[model samples]
Target: MAKVLYIKANPKQASNTFLISDSFIKAYKEKNPADQITTLDLYREGIDFLRERDLGDMGDPEKLEDRNHRVFKYAYQFLEGDKYVIAAPFWNLSFPAILKAYIDYICISSLTFKYTEEGPVGLLAGRKAIYITTRGGNYSSEKTRALDQGEPYLKTILGFLGITDFTVLSADCLDVIGVDKDEILRAAIREAENLAQKF
Candidate 1:
């Protein structure tokens, strides 16, 4: 059975991003009944960002091997997951700062990635990731897709960790003027469910 880690960044149940994620989870569970699904609510978890104390741990050879250390806690958890689901809303052309903090916690050497003569090599190779998000503007087009830095930024980070199978399910133009919010969400929810079956 695969270990699925669902990372939720938004707190609102009615959020378009969360709704799509919920649909995907429901579908995924139905399709893969034996899979172990764990939900990490970032808002509720209250994960801390890197600080002075963490700085020293990152460089310590002892802490790298000691998984019990606080510095390796989140990174260890992240590495253990076989599949990942991240849900967040677009804010300031990116996701929430808490999500970035969570990434900071996991982007550790020997856990997520390591340096090599060739360059940094990611450890979480062959893992799969699904990102669910919503944007106010239409950022799906070739002309505007570059404006949405959240998806690409996340894909890049996860790729650095050896996850090449990255999928993004975004509900775009939800809050656009004269756009039908309900219709936009419904389509996204449908797409999310479809992807979960094959994900």
Candidate 2:
């Protein structure tokens, strides 16, 4: 059975982004009922917060520390998964810091990746990811010129780990003026459901 890692980043329980994410989860579960799903709520459940020891542990795997143990355990769990889903709200034109920290924990040296004379090699393979998000402002218009730090960063990081296939479903202008959030969300759910069928 495939193991799925579901990361949720919305702090507000009632937030539209969270609801959309939950919808995606429901659809994913329906499609792949046998797949194991692990949900990580970064805001409420707490992520592996960065610390000096966590970095130090990467250099020497032989040494065991409390923070290092948590980092290793989290990395193992991440590597064990076959699929990953990141559901987060676009915050301040970017993704949340908690997600960033979680990435830091997984992408450690001699763990999820390796450095060679040629280049960096991803230890984890045969994995795919899906990004589900909602933004307050429309990033479609050139006049808005809004930068989407969420998708780009996620793509880069996952690509670094050799996850090549991923899809993004975004509902922009969620809180912006004159934008109908309910309509956008319904459309996003339809799109998500379609993706679920293929997934």
Candidate 3:
């Protein structure tokens, strides 16, 4: 069975972002019952920002190869995943700081990537990722897409790790005036269900 890592960046269960997550997870579990799924709620996880001790081996690639290192736990877990499902809300044109902090912990040398004569090469090739996000003001539009750094930043990071097969399921115009939030959420839920079948 493939390992599915589901990362939740939002805390509120009632939030539109988490509503999408709830739907996705439910459908994914039903469709891929044999798959091994691991859920990591970042807010409940209390993931800390990288501290000095966490980066003690930042300069040493050899040290990173030691999977037993306390700081390497995140990297190792990330590497073990065959697929990833990340759920977050668009905040201030980006995602939550906790999610960014989690990213820093996973992007370690000798685990997710390594430097070569040419440049750094990602090790986790062929892995796939699905980004699920909700935006209050319709960041998906061309007029405002550039303003949304949350999804793009996450995609770039995952791509850098050689996980190029990516999909995005977003719920937009959540808080915008006159927008039908319920209709948007229903459509997103339907999309999530459809995507889970092939995921």
Candidate 4:
């Protein structure tokens, strides 16, 4: 059975993004009962930013530290998964710092990708990713797309890792004044459910 790795970046218990992701996972599980699912909650299982020592260990595999081992483990888990799902809320035009740290740990050279004679090429193939994000403001419009670093940045990074196939489910204008927050969230949840069936 194919493995699905679900990465949770939203720490808040009541976060709309988390709720949407949960709905998707539930539907996915129901549709694909034989599939294996794994979750990595960034807040619960903390990830640190790469430091000098971490970089040094990455350069020389022989001189591995405890933290480096954990980082490598994360990288290995990422490679093992056939599909991925990232659930995060847009924060300050981007995602949370913990999610960034998690990304840093997984984007290992020679593991996720490698530099070739022409340029950097992704190593992992035949994998796909689904990104679920909730934005406080409406950032999906042409006028505001440039300001949306969260979704665009994720797409770029995952593509760098050879995961070119992606499905983005975004719930925007969540915190906009006078907006029907409940209705927007319900619609997003329904969309998530529909996508899960074919994901």
Q: Which of the two, 3 or 4, has more lDDT?
A: 4
TM-score of 4: 0.95
Candidate 3: worst-modelled 10 consecutive residues by lDDT: 53-62
In order of lDDT, best first, we have 1, 4, 3, 2
Scored against the true structure, residue 38 in model 3 reaches a CA lDDT of: 93
CA RMSD, predictions in order? 1.2, 2.2, 1.5, 1.9
Q: What is the lDDT of candidate 1?
A: 0.92
Of the candidates shown, which would achieve the greatest TM-score relative to the real structure? 1
Compared with the true structure, what per-residue lDDT tens digits does model 2 show for residues 6-48? 8888778887776777788888799889989998887776785
| TM-score of each prediction | 0.96, 0.91, 0.94, 0.95
Ranking by TM-score: 1, 4, 3, 2
State the lDDT of candidate 3 residue by residue for 57-150, as single tens digits: 7766677777777678788998889999999998899998999999998998777998899999999999999999988887877798999888
As a whole number from 0 to 100, the lDDT of residue 74 in candidate 4 is 88
Better of 1 and 4 by lDDT: 1
TM-score of 3: 0.94
lDDT score, residue 130, model 1? 93
- Give the residue spans of candidate 3 off by over 4 A: 60-68
Model 2 poorest ten-residue lDDT run? 59-68
lDDT, candidate 1, residue 38? Answer: 92
